[model samples]
Target: MNLKESEPTASASLSRRKFIAGTGLLLAGATLKLQANPLVSGAPLSTLFAEPIIDIHQHTDYMGRTTDQLIAHQRAMGITKTILLPSGRPVNSASTHFGVGNGLQAKATGNTICYGLAKKYPKEFLFGANEVPDVPEAIEEIERYLKLGACVIGESKFGVECDSPEMQKIYELAQAYNVPVLMHWQYGMYNYGLERFHKMLEKYPKVNFIGHSQTWWANIDKNHLDQKVLYPKTKVTPGGLTDQLLSNYENIYGDFGAGSGLGSMTRDEDHARIFIEKHQDKLLFGSDCTDITGHIDNCLGAKIIAEVRKLSPTKKIERKILYHNAKKLFRL
Candidate 1:
């Protein structure tokens, strides 16, 4: 027997490697398809997913994720375009409040990384500029990114009063840049003072204000008791503060992202449908999840998509919330 006949050639070995790699990707994709079926039901979350989504809010280096993982996560969700919102420069000294948990901190995830990623993956990404609102140079830094073509102005998830002078400056920048501002409105934590936030909304009428987080969502219940309650499971009272803001203020919009966003929608299905139809034009779909696979026992973003689909009265309304609203607001 000739050894050459028995031994695998270099081309054969290369072919085998390619085949194995392809198989792994196929397996992963198949698993995702199965998981997505329950959420999307009729179809899987492929690049051709029904919504043609544009994720208005996402982060780079989120929760210690690698760059490839970050891209993979967005691609897995079938997001048509994504806006990467970087954190402002972290303070050198400790402050009264730095937010809860690892993901909530005001770290210095700068505009450079976001710019680089957006530049490198223009088809997949666009970025937003942000800076620590209280800092003296905050407006200057934010302006720099805005001039550099940041499509949006936040993830303003800092430990400052929502209507503070510092936050006002950021909102002013939004007006100047002619871009929307996405605020993370937690009650006692980040972006404090939801009740007074109306003042800023009034002050910055020309600027589109996108609200996210627990406090903003929880306000959908008129009988909401605690300011710090992240998720309110009570029956929605038809016309809550959130409803009013979305109704009365033309500039105000909702970001259906993260646990808070999903909680607000799913907390009451009946109300969610009404809210979905009524405010279809004012809502934007954003997956603020840090999950790389975009599939889990409970991926907040996927669940929100499902909820919106389930609750939206018409296909047009569902499309508006899922992507059209974000596209028009962000000018993507």
Candidate 2:
């Protein structure tokens, strides 16, 4: 399909912005506290695993925290390395936190902020370039950052289907640059049409696609029937699409971060254990938690590390999930 042909007309785009603005007011009343604590305790995850961790999924801006606070927080969690993914789209109307901006402006702001952080803390933080796949200058914008050493392309939170022609263009960019494409896949939010996403995997054999968010996690249970596809706490059944996809696709990977990731692991211990063991090499450790506490226990990030350690049959496998796998994939 020709994606450019499907682009919304100017009038339609304007109307959509108006609608978003109207709804944004209702959400603007809520606020996020992005301050950093003076004393951050690093004892939680440090006591759990001796191996240093590499968090492949994280954000520098969305939480409203400064770069210094972000670095301090990662250190507190024993994260030796972190990939800072910036969102290309505006903070959604329903979201109470993150700044309000969209499209090129937002993407530029995130790229500038993350790149600065990466430069300051060269060893600790690495950054990715984010672009809205459906935008007109997406490829050009992404290429500009890739030339400047963006190791990854994404946290793509655009309103497009996973297999849309627009996303294919972005995948081409990733393949050209030899970098992974990280995506946020919520059913109704960014990267819709998850059921047909396998076609993209088949097509882009060289482009690594890291899947995140509720829609991706929902498919972990083969019996997941709800269309809502957000935060399902029921016991997970085997033979889920996520497992099947990981087993079959070498380039596809899982970002185990945020509420969806921790919930998936904690919802069913037996299922999570089996899943982790089965796809140990394909899953990457991440802390999508934006909380400023710096301690893992203070947020779901700590629980995720603890769960992975508990479920991993051996220290070797635990290291693979928590640190080694990300090291290899991102080439840290």
**lDDT by residue for model 2 (60-150), tens:** 7544666667766777677877888766645543221233335322223467777878887776779899866665777887888789899
* RMSD after Cα superposition, model 2: 21.7
How many residue pairs in model 2 have overlapping backbones?
A: 0
- Among all windows of 10 consecutive residues in model 1, the one with the lowest summed lDDT is 93-102
Give TM per candidate: 0.82, 0.80
lDDT for 176 (candidate 2): 93
TM-score of 2: 0.80
Residue pairs with colliding backbones in model 1 are: none
Q: Alpha carbon lDDT of residue 213, candidate 1?
A: 84
- Kindly list the per-residue Cα lDDT of model 1 for residues 1-332, writing each as its tens digit: 99999999999999999999999999999987766752344243443565588888888887787888877677666676888988777565222254342234623256899999999977778999987777778899889988989988887877777777877877887888899999888776677777877888887889999999888889988888787678878788877788889999999999988888888877788889888888889999988887777764556666777778888999999889888888888876
Q: How well does candidate 2 score on lDDT at residue 266? A: 85
